[model samples]
Target chain A: MTVVTDGQERAGDVRLGRVGRGVRVAVALVGIGLLINGSVRASDDAWPFGPMSQYAMSVPDDASITYTRISAQTDAGTTVDVPLNIEGAGVARAEIEARTGEIVKDPSLLQQVADGWAKKHPDKPKYVKLELIRDTTQLVKGRVVGPPTPAVLATWEVRR
Target chain B: MSARTVATRAANWFTPAIAFARIAWLRTVLYLFVIVDMHAFVRDTRLKGEHPGLYQPLLLARMFDLPKPTVFNTTALYVVLIAACLVGASNYFPRIAGWIVAPAFTWWVLIGMSDGKVDHDHLALVIALWVLPTVKAGRRGRASYNDQARSESAGWVIRCVQICVIATYFLSAIAKLRSAGWALTWPGSAVLTWAIVRRPHPVGEWLLHHPWMLHVMQWVGITAEFLSPVILWLKGRWQLFGALFFLGFHAANTAILLIHFLPTVVCWLAFAPMERIVPWFQRRRASDSDAGEAEDQAEHGREAKEQAGA
Candidate 1:
């Protein structure tokens, strides 16, 4: 092949290899859009370009996550386990659990959590009390499920 | 030759040319990582596709009004993503393959992140994927070039990624400011306890007692984030120091939190002298060729001298 030294042609047919004025303008516009998209207005799924906001804010001193079986008294006064307390949320269970810990200290937030829960399980009867009882399971990482050591961390209560 | 030295090359404004070998090297690393990343999610992705009800379209997906995320759709998208990465990495039909890699991987990222567990660490990587295809990089394995063809465009592509790296840090600082109340009383120290209670490791437990240290780390993290843009403008030792500092930041983050931004860290190659490897090799090749030419000239000189005597 003859030597072409004008610094523009490639043997391959790649689109941007030639670097035209239009391509440069397009790249500049795209770059600006990318930089702005995430920081200005990130979409619901995820903004790869936005502010790295995860763990950006500080967790309060009293903030903590507890693994416990939440129990609530049914209208019939029978205590039943709140099944929504735990599931297959890898690592995120901590955040949910932590939020529960927060609601325990500040019962005023109970209405929001309850409203969301009611929306999810519309059929379940309203409970009189919400208490997270520690599971007596020894947590194992990879193998068998160990029993959580049961401990109670109470959050909300109904006078009725 | 007008590309100048490694240290000055990036500084050259609008230097459109780039070494093709560098493109080849970067593509291999990026394509492999993107492929492996998708591979890890194959079963999960396929599951998402199968369970159309669970397929929550993210903003981009919603805007595109993509077809329902049926098991067929999810799996098919991944299939395309993986195939594009493989063919692009292998450069089987290079130009076509290169064009295929970016959008396929992008679609996979949007789909994969639809569950609301989005990580911004891969944005620079995605940018890399898109920008990389623009350059007509040489064959795989080689990392240097002897020609000026396409060097300018490669430079532009790499510059875009480098900016992304800087943006990650620069914007992270902005994020911290938005939330971190900035005083010593800022409960940033509580993050250790917050994370520890979830995982309950010995080191984390120990650190919990040392709240003051966590506070110190918070200040350090913010400072590092704010100063991160130095990687672009800083020269010589300072630039290297900035890079090392960021690497340490990632390392400490992974060690403590078990969160690794492996892709973004890999994209840090844009700031590094990676493209220089090709230029160095090219310099050696040129020198060797020059030496060979000098030897031939000397032999002809000797022969001509003999003929003159005759």
Candidate 2:
């Protein structure tokens, strides 16, 4: 029943008692400190308090932009682009991009994408071989110069 | 200023009394939004569980030694979270439901964003969840929608949410500056152009032709974000304008880059006087009913006079 009217503390108005106020102040200070530390020093690993670095890096106008995509040779004897979406392969393009280094270091890791695809689409033509492809587009003065060049960074042949 | 005076001023600023009803309204909005968020936005948590090998736990998850998301655990978390959020939105058992939702959603978000890309938009949202449970309602464990009673606890929680929301913007500007090697090169760079070209919508594709306009937008965006804290001190219409401007900013980002920072956007309601919403609706309904009653009386009076004449 505690209420505050016009800056006057009326009886029964719920107040943050001395201890409550102190605790909150401490928590706020710590939280803000961590946020500052994260921005200054930490990486995405310190998430929920880490650097707010989405699109933080600047891309040069003339720089080449690379997009990673999965290309697969299906059992149907046709080469098709495997979508990097949850519905497509049970994984997102960002997920693949995040593990690009690991996948590049170990080409066999591409088998997981094949497994994911098989799990999602059991009736569809299974992937016979999976290639981790990078399509690089050259940009000049912030405009695309020409068609993108697709390069295969890693490949995995289905063992089945 | 004297040390005692400084302490008193700081205390007053942190614990300004605010209507408890605002918390009730905000809780409903935020908890309900969690359902929308889980299904539409971070729908990959369950799928990520299926591919546990891909789960690269973040720092907090790692520190907590949270088990790598499994089909069983993730599904369990999903069910628990939905149920808790629904109950929390109902305004019953506020603390219990709020506490359950706070950690579960945090863990859910942590799992969903375990990939190399952790979105900055979630910072304020996650903080709001944690702090909301600390504020208690009346003895019945619920704050009425029309409750005029103001509490310092409510103010503190709202302040925390507001601070985090502003921090999301202010810190992002700092991050941009840092990433540009502590130089002011970011605003002048073709970051927006690069993004547009990377994920080309029709509008963004057309924007690709106007690189100078994109550069100007980058400068304007960074400057506004850096100066975003001023919104906290702004009163009345200015504050609303600031909030609307950011919402517009989000709308523009969504239109161009297909990126919507809804999590942070929803938290902007903290800056609003949401306690008035329920009262406003109630008054309108009451007035409508009163007019109906007056019309009924007039009709009865006319019918009585006609009967007497007949």
Task: Write candidate 2's Cα lDDT for A1-160 as tens digits.
Answer: 2222224455656777889888887788788899999999999899888988998888887889888889999999999999888788878888888899999998877787889889889999999999999989888877778888999998889777
TM-score of chain B of 1: 0.78
lDDT of 1 by residue, B234-295 (tens): 65567788888989999988877766788889888776544445445445555567777656
How far out, in Å, is residue A23 in model 1? 4.5
TM-score of candidate 2 against the unseen true structure? 0.91
Enumerate clash totals for all models, in the order shown.
21, 3
Q: What would the TM-scores of all predictions be?
A: 0.66, 0.91
**Which pairs of residues collide in candidate 2?**
A2-A12, A2-A13, A3-A13
The DockQ leader among the candidates is 2
lDDT of 1 at B247: 94
Quote the positional error of residue B218 for candidate 2 in Å: 0.5
| CAPRI grade, predicted model 2 | acceptable
lDDT of 1 by residue, A71-102 (tens): 66767678876654212211133333545546
The top-ranked prediction according to TM-score is 2
